[model samples]
Target: MKTIGLFAVIMSAAMTVQAKQVAPTSSKISPATIDQAIRLAEATSKEGVTKKITIVTTDNGKSTDVSPRYTVYLGYNSMAEMGNISAAYLIAEDAYSNVTAKRLAPGIYQVQYKAYRDEAGMVNVTKVIDANEAFINDNEIRKACADDFCDGTIKAAVDVQESTTSAN
Candidate 1:
């Protein structure tokens, strides 16, 4: 009985460790938002679109629209920094039209998305704005530790330091 109990405890401990390492996170954007983002990318012209899309927050708060970007770049820096390509991709995709959004004060998410024309995307952006908004609200630390890997920030700092040393 003692041996059986000890074995069970060991197994449980191992399982817990494994679970934390592979913990799953849901996508920040909803299916509706994804659809709208996709449509905005597909649209060829903006025409007479006059609707403002407001994205609902995960915490039931409303997202304030800051400056909209007509051109965007895939946020490779953020992705390399965060090491969570999935989450980065979602934010980038959503950003194609709406660009960046301001959630918490003092933090402006500058993660870029694939560049799409500002004029054509506004209509789809409005359509999705009434729904949920996808934005990068996570801070650098959170993004770096998203998958529990947690070494990206340190690695980035080291790389920067090395570059500086080489330049000097």
Candidate 2:
């Protein structure tokens, strides 16, 4: 089992992918590079794979102003799904409300967001649901307006899936 800096690769590939039009664009990343990235997961073994990603928060107890920051360090079991990361930011609860998340390190992430405050009875805009591996496996992220007390309205989201090819 080998560990790779997939986060770095993913970020770089992110830029290269943005310049494409379903027709090869003028990027340093060649078609072969993209193909290699797609095949990276197939070559790696998932035996010793472990992923530790945490979401630390502040002012979450009171339905006041909710802001969560983390230095995210994520270890994926496989790079099989690396291509979908570019679309990760596009995940949102509704057409009017959304979260913009960035991964800095394990347990270190910065999440700046907007919730539809005017969306009828949606005052509790400080609640967010805990997301774990299971939630991701289901391809959905859940958000809330409150906690144990009344726990605000429940909202769910799914990441858009797209593919980009690359290799280190």
Candidate 3:
């Protein structure tokens, strides 16, 4: 009985360790897929067609009209002192728009935009704005953005603008 009890305890301990060691599976979707889905969803829904979006950067406190140039791309941050951190999503309102790529250090930023629906129930137009390094820290760039920097200020600004505009 004593041996059986000890064996059971050891098995349970081993199972617990194995469970802890299990790696999480990735649920990551590619940018192209996301873009396609957004486009498709917009095409299917009349409400999504006329939905306007506004992107605002909290760092500069200046808002630009970005409706005619909605394009998304991969971006990287390079600093002379800090070196290059990681790649991030870069959405723009224009193909020729200039993003202040070099000056942005570790900081928080906001991008706001509006999309207008066309007669075919598609989001034919979108307005996008970008801000670089509105907030930054020395941790993993992607992880940091996902956790702390992306949500608080940027989301608040977006929410406030959306609410105020929708009300008006």
lDDT of each: 0.26, 0.25, 0.27
Instruction: Identify the superior model by TM-score, candidate 2 or candidate 3.
Output: 3
Query: What is the clash count for each candidate, in the order shown?
Result: 2, 14, 23
Best by TM-score: 3
Best-to-worst TM-score order: 3, 2, 1
Every model: Cα RMSD to truth: 22.8, 21.6, 22.7
Runs in model 1 lying further than 4 Å from the true structure: 1-87, 92-100, 104-168
Per-model TM-score on C-alpha atoms: 0.17, 0.20, 0.23
lDDT computed for candidate 1: 0.26
Tens digit of per-residue lDDT, candidate 3, span 1-168: 999999986565331111111111222335443322121100112312121122211122224743333343323222222232333343433322222211122222222233332322222222222222222321334345543333221211110101101101
Candidate 1: tens digits of C-alpha lDDT, residues 1-168:
999999986565331111101111233444333322211211111322121212222212234553333322112122333232222222222333334332222112222222323433322221111011112322344454655743322111100000000100
Q: How close is candidate 3 to the true structure, as a TM-score?
A: 0.23
Per-residue accuracy of model 2 over 70-116 as CA lDDT, tens digit each: 11111122222321211111112321123234453322333333333
